[model samples]
Target: MLQRKTTKLINKHLLMSLVVVAFASTSLELAYAQKNQTATKKKSSDISLTSDDKIFLELREASKNNEASKAKDLGQKLSNYDIADYVAYFQIKPRLFDKGGAPRAETMADDAVDQFLKKYDGTALADRLRNDWLLVLGKRKDWPTFDREYAQFVLDDDTQVKCYALQSRLTKGESVNVLAAEVKNILLDSRYFGDACPDLVNSIYKANGFSKHEVATFSRMAVENNFETLANRFDVPDPMADIVRSARKSPEVAFRDFDKKAWRTSKENTAAAWGSVGQYLAKKLDPNGLKAFKMQHELGHHHLLTPETQEWKVRAALREGDWRIVKETIDHMTPSVRKRDPAWTYWHARAQKELGDESLAKESLQALSDQYHFYGQLAREDLGMKIHVPKRVAADESLVKQASSNKAFARAVRFYDMGLRFEGNREWNWELRNLSDKQLIAVAEHAKRIGLYDRAVNTADRTKLEHDFSLRYPTPFKESLAPIAGSIGLDTNWAYGLIRQESRFIMNARSHVGASGLMQVMPATAKYVAKKIGMNSFKPSQLDDMKVNLTLGSNYLNMVLQDLDGSWALASAAYNAGPGRPKMWREKLPRVVEGAIFAETIPFNETRGYVKNVLANASYYTAMSSNKTPSLKQNLGTVSPKASVLSELP
Candidate 1:
């Protein structure tokens, strides 16, 4: 029942299940057998519980429903439960919201939390409970208990918590200037880090830790990034904040309005404000705005341009293929700004090459080629070197045995076997914190032996001295993939490359947006492809079937590939970020641009990265499959607005 275009692909052959490369001789079946055996040997004998266990479930349900009388009744019947910590947590959690005044509620919550922490001090749930307790203490303004509990709180990256901690320090007459850098970082972050962060920013400004000029700089930055709520709270005057807000909808009017008020502020501050609006226009894909702004206005010397302004200047020039201007903008940036990010460093070298300064460009590329990243691969390509992948080293029995015996690793394995991957990955990564490079390699090898391909790839990436290409860039479903790709006239390496980036060989990996299976196809996309290919009675659930999913995914990819005129770079971007977005991005180009520059200028951060990684992965896969060096430049061929004859290929 396949459509004419797809019938030949399906009729070509049977499914192949054997993998091509063998980093470890352990097959998927053998790994599953090992997991089953381990589970059988280690499973606790007393899994089923007595009638008393029903009380625990009742208490949990009562707590969830916020039923105070039901919880109170269940609490009296739970004294004999073996899980004393959980029982205590379930009893106290609902009561933390008690309306009987703040101090009394906090004291009750604190006592219950302290008891749980005392009993289960090292467990993950204890830390989770402590966060709830800290929130109560923060609300009650009990700085003493809040400080003590906050100090003991691990994983302290919560922005709101840090803001409260700062409030406590400031209340005690501590100089906020001592934490100036940290304050700026947390305050300026784009995400709404909750009310506490804005409250902390207001506190710091009132405390004179942030000067008027500093406050204005942050406001301008907020407006440039279209964070209006943040811009409004920076104490900028209502009229000026209004002008900044207008930049999003009317950049030209915003720029003119900003100019009229230029003489009211200091020259440097005025430049900063002007730069913010200009950057906004550039980011909005206004082709002439940035170039005209630079030509007509005085931004002082190159070194005096704000980091934000310089970044937009470089981006605008790169978008228009003006290499000289790109080099000039980068040269004006501070050494720290230019040197910190590999993206800027790579672009500086690229500009140098286009400007016929190969000596300097070569030096920059040479230094960057040694690292592993999107830019590093580009640097390697610029230097005419193949992507260097280290030889696969087999794991020794002794190393494997040692890794299996490690307590934390064993806990992770047990968690994975119990279908608790979230907990398993957490335990696994947490244990990796203090491991030596050699120990990490051994642990990665053990993960590979157990068919934890995702863990194996991630863990192997951590090693400094040793490198293993086969483990890092594995082709897990080669037998099923190769013939299907060939039958469809698609590059097997390219298909594998896209799949590896999409799911990392995790068959059941579901994205946050519900993209499922090996190729991460959405249910709607699957249905459409299924119907288009004359597949009858197609159930959405068939997306989980490996062959069906690959058939639909590869066909969709090939369709996109042809529609975009055989440009893998565009097709890769199209696959991740839809076909419409890349077309719009291409239209923004003043003229046909190099694929690298086009990729670097993609407005969506995720899609930009997706295109680069997929192409780079395809290049490496090509090298591995053909046993010859693949040209990264050829892989990322120049993208143009016009379609090619390949678009007509059927």
Candidate 2:
């Protein structure tokens, strides 16, 4: 019995030992597997591969194949992934809920709302989404959320006028008050939005209940729009008076009507009757004569009209030294009329001097300084003699005094006034190169107040020492830029450097191609950026505001930086051209170094030159200012893949 019991115990112990060993081996295998899995996950995360990552990959593939349906599906998936992923959300939402097909009203509404909430920071993108939402929702008043959003929407000038007009009709309210205010605003702010006045004026007229002033305003606008029938309704003095006045001031008129015989024959007829003169001139003048006449018109002199013969008659007075005729002409001339003629520069100076008004004479001479080349260089030389260029004032003592003194605002204004005067005289360019840092700051501050942000930025940039270009780089904003810069992982120096180069820091700077604000951002670009930032109701005007411009600009810079594989140099280059071009450039030059070779080889002269200037400016700024400059070469790595795609052709 004892032997049998011992045998059973031995068997049990062996079985138990085997079980323990098996368990240990299994545990070790599980641990190893988990470790490998974690490592794999870390690798994938490092490469930005999440479950939703395939959506982007698929979308790209779909785009490559031009597979709209697949792209739309993937886009929807990406958009629905997370609200915080603005880029993906904006990218996918539009495709998912396209406007062309039977509109997925609910989907579009949600997408727009998502876009708005994400980019609520007042970006151009946000405004676009909001506009989109309003457009899609139409007159549907049931959606309280849409109504609420609309109520808070920051309507642009055109939209505001339209909204007011619509509200007046919907609510049975008088639009005259709103129309009047808008008309006045339009007139005052005409330069802000050029050539869009007719549409706005028409919208105002269409609104309910028009007043006499509104009628008159509409009549004038009608004439401007070439709707002569509507324009002739209001029996105001010949509706063509303003046009005649405009034509009279135009230089082309003078050249066309140069024939004294034609003028003597047509003197009795109305000004509009002189349209024949333009036709005659067009027939008679050669291309060069026509070109010269057009150039003169652009120069803002109008010597064409029969009614203005008296003004020209005064020119003869000056030529013949007939002071009595000059005095008589001056007496009869309106200030507006007096201001138009370049001969006034000479006449005004002579008259002021003869009248023994030394101060007035000096003022006239200063005004005529710019006209020196057109009239004669004598006036400018005389003015230069009297007004010695102001010495460069030290910023340390003078700045503090100017900043604190009651005259601080006044002094800054005076500096700007002088700057303008210099600009008018074409002297600012030379004077700017010699300005003290203190003077530049003062001028910049003054420009900010007067809405000349671009000039201020330029002045600051020009005054900055080439070496210390980055130091204390002036921004239009007083605060909040650092946080924005941080959010986008951008070097403030680089940002400031770009701002300086792009617009010379001008808030209202616009390019001939329709870019606006300090960054010279295109409207379409601003719209995209605004939507990306989720600013639901951004107006284009807000771009002029420093904070908005910087925030959007920084975000855009960040996007470009990422797209260019973290190369600041390439990013800067891409910023000038689009990312696709840079990507192509990098692909084509895969063996080259980023900064030295690829950047140097960029095809677009404008972009290549721009990149070099920006980089140099940034380096200088970083050195002078406290900011650290990142290495252009270090940040952007060596070229990698020889992309089969086309080289980024700038």
Identify the candidate with maximal TM-score: 1
Residue 84, model 2: Cα distance from true site in angstroms = 59
TM-score on alpha carbons, each prediction: 0.75, 0.33
Query: What is each predicted model's overall lDDT from 0 to 1?
Result: 0.66, 0.44
User: Tens digits of per-residue lDDT for model 1 on 443-479?
Assistant: 8788877787777877766766666666666787788
Q: In candidate 1, which residue pairs get closer than 3 Å at backbone N, Cα or C atoms, i.e. clash?
A: none
Which ten contiguous residues of candidate 1 have the minimum total lDDT?
1-10
Question: Which candidate should be chosen as best, given lDDT against the real structure?
Answer: 1
- What TM-score does structure 1 among the candidates reach? 0.75
| Prediction 1 global C-alpha lDDT | 0.66
In the range 282-350, model 2's lDDT, one tens digit per residue, is 222212223332332333223222223334334334333445545545655444456544555566666
